[model samples]
Target chain A: MKVNYFISDIFYVCLRDLKHYLKQRVRIMATLIQPIIWLVLIGNLMSGLTANPLTLKFLDAPSYLDFMAPGVMVMTTLFTGLFAGVRVVWDRRLEILQKMLSTPLSRTAIPLGKIAAAVVQGNIQVIIVLLTALMLGVTFKTGLAGIMVILIFISLFCSIMASISIALSVNIRNMETFFALMNFITMPLMLTSKAMFPVEAMPGWLKFIAEWNPISYAVIPLRTLVTKGWDWTVIWQSLIILCFFALCFLAGAVFFFKRARA
Target chain B: MKNIIEVKSLSKIFPGKITAVNKISFSVKQGEIFGFLGPNGAGKSTTIMMLTTLHLPSSGTAFVSGYEIKKSPRSVRMQFGYVSQDLAVDDRLTGYENLFLQAKYYHIPNQTARERIKILLNLVELEKRAKDLVETYSGGMRKRLDIACGLIHRPKILFLDEPTLGLDIHTRRQIWQYITDLREKQGITIFLTTHYMDEADSLCDRIAIIDHGVIKVLGTPQELKSRLGGDIITLDIALTHVAKIPRLIKLLKTLTNIKQIKTAKTKITIVTLHAESMMADILKIIQKNSIPLEMVMLKTPSLDDVFLNFTGRSLRDEAGNREQAHKARRMLRRIRS
Candidate 1:
């Protein structure tokens, strides 16, 4: 019975967030439009860079769109997951969080539910990105199984990003400050990782940073599944790393949420 | 009736060593409308937070419906409904949805939650707007919905931290009606904190006047007023004449009919046996001293007088400043959002 309540608490929290997300028509429009712009414009624009035989051989993909689609899907996830904490900040400002805290619901349920909502949203955007890529003539090498793997990668990556966002938001009360911090962190993470380019093409120092970047672990597996078939060696290494980071950040998020103050 | 809430020297000192709620002890009787009356920053909300299990006490503890707040917060939380000072209802959700979400927080089953939401929407008179998003709700309607959300679980006690702080007078009175009905109809004990004197005097069965993190006095409205025991002559002086308050009090001290004199801001309250008979002498002294009196009125002792007599300041004066600040902050938040 106790476990039942805990699970229901998480469900309701996630449900409320989804309800809010669905109500904002403009936000939904923006979410759909953003990934399409990146895929159609940036994907085509960067395709020229990989047009050379030498570059194509190094890229090991039929087209630039195939290599970049997975990166763009993870990028969308990155943006959504990082901003998930904005809701927590707003809830704190409005005292909705305090009201929830006063309830009998477990504190861990709050952040876990928010992470769940972000993962769901991340998957929705991933699907949209994938369909757009498919419409743009990008084919997956691993077929249906690869698509499922990509969804799992996005969910794990989103949970990691969202957990960090929420953990920071629990301490930082101001929305402006949270926005500044998210921007500072997101730009470095997105550009330094192999999201938009091949890490092999990056300079020595940048490649080192990209290899160490957690986001690359997520994007690498996704790119491999899309461009090169299911290579278990590469997939397993990145998957384990993603799972470890997800676990650590989720534990941190729950810890901060339990101590959240109005 | 037994005590529904028992706070024993509950104190909260923030990290900076700022004591928000000092060692204050009070017991609220079951099925009673108990008011925590104080100005802003007087530990009213802190006490409520501690009782609601949102903030851990630094040194002492409290119990709600026999569950200790610190040791068993979930059990304590299960017993009370909390309506915070800010509007905590989700604007994106319909009124029904808001109440349903609250019911889910308490683990109320869907079937029971729907039934409770229907009854609550009707009770709060939001039946017409039940399906509309709360963003469309007026200030009063949103507050009513907030109160209904608090009641969805049908907890034994309800904690309202300034439930009507920003609403207009009409809406404030309407909320008061709902609060009274909750106690009378459902026998739910209510613990509310407010800076409004009229709200406390009219609605609360018992009032605890707190100031600077301490409870100065606690009693029923009548008991507090009768403790002052006589008529009161209040003199409101202009801001320019604030310095003259000392002379006015000194002069009024000479009158045999006047028992005690208190000065808060620019208002001088004189406790006397017969205010009407003492009026002539008071006016003569004011006129001679050229104190520039703005207004004068003589009436029986009220909760305002009781507050002034204990805290040496008028509740209305502090509340007026706080109300302005509260409204400004709310306006800024609305514009920014």
Candidate 2:
């Protein structure tokens, strides 16, 4: 019976957020438009650099669009996941958090439910990016199975970002301070990783940072699935690393949430 | 009636070493409208927070519906509904959606929740606007919906923290009617906190006046008022006759059943057992002396006089800043949206 209440708590919280997300027509339009701009504009603009044989060999694909599709999908997930805590901050200001905390709902379920909703939202954006990439002539070498693997990676990657965002939100009360800190963290995480560029083409110091970056773990496996199918050796190593980071960050989020005062 | 809530020496000192609620003890009878009346920072909200299990007491404890707040918070939480000072309803969702979500949090079954929601929406008179988003609701409608949300679980007790703050007099009276109706129809005990003197006088069965983290007095409105022990008669003479005030005081002292006399400027206040019977004699004396009388006013002791008698300060003086702050916040919300 106790376990049943906990599960339902998570379900109801997630359902509320999902309903809130769907009701904003303007936000839905923005979500659809964002991935299309990144894929069509940025993907084609960088295609000239990969036209040469050396760059094509480095990219491990015939064209830049094909190689960058998976990276774009992961980047979209990264952006979506990092902003999940904005809703929490909004709820806090509006006193909705106080109402929920006063109920019998468990503290852990609050952040978990928000993270779950972010993952679902992230996956939706990933599919949009994938469809746009396909329309732009990018083909998946592993087809349907590879698409499933990409989605799993996206979910894991999004959870890590969402967890970190929620942890920061629970600790920081000011909305402007949270947004400033997010910008300070997000750009470096995205730029230093292989999400937009190849790590082999980077300088020695950046390669070290990219090698240690968690985004790279998600990007590497997703890129391998998209460009070089069935490479279990590379995929398994990164998958394990992604799972480990997700667990650590999620635990940190729950700790902060439990200790937060209304 | 038995006590539904018993608080024993409860205290809360925040991390900054600021004491918000001192060691205070009180009991609220079941089915009674108990009020905590105080100024803005008088620890009223802190006490409510502790009882609602939203904040852990730094020391001491409380029991709600036979469950200790600290030992079995989940059980305690299930026993009462809380409506905070802020309007906590979700604006993006419909009124029905807001109450449905609240019902789900309490684990009410779906069919029962629907029926309860229907009745609650009707009770608050929001049945006509149930399907519209709460953002479209007027201030009164939004507050009514907030009250309905609190009643969705049908808890044994309801805690309202400034339920009528920032509302017009009409809306405030409407909210009061709902509160009284709840107690009469459902027998639900109510614990409310407000700084409004009239609200405490007219609505609460018993009121505790708190200040500086301590409760100063607790009694019914009539009891507190009568404790001051007499009617007040104030006579304002013309400035030309100010010199005769001392003589007037001496003459008034000769009257029977007079308690105390005080003078400031041209006005003299006479506290007596019966102002009605003494009015004729006092007027005849004033006329016989030919002291240029300007005005005479008589008043029975009210809750304000009781508050002033105990706290040595007027309640309205302390409430001024808070009322302005509330206005500024409301203005900011309006500008933002």
Report how far residue B209 has shifted in candidate 1, in Å: 0.7
lDDT of 2 by residue, B137-243 (tens): 98888889988988888989999988887788999999999999999999999999886889988999999988878999998987787689888899999999888
The whole-model C-alpha lDDT of candidate 2 against the native structure comes to: 0.88
Candidate 1 lDDT at A137 equals: 89
Chain B structural similarity as TM-score, candidate 2: 0.82
Cα distance off (Å), candidate 1, residue A106: 1.1
Q: TM-scores across all candidates?
A: 0.88, 0.90
Give candidate 1 misplaced runs (Cα > 4 Å). B232-298, B321-323, B327-337
Q: Please provide, for model 1 over B242-293, each residue's C-alpha lDDT reduced to its tens digit, 9 standing for 90 to 100.
A: 8778877877898896788888898888887777778999899989988787
Model 1 interface DockQ:
0.47
Model 1's alpha-carbon lDDT is 0.88
Which candidate number has the best TM-score? 2
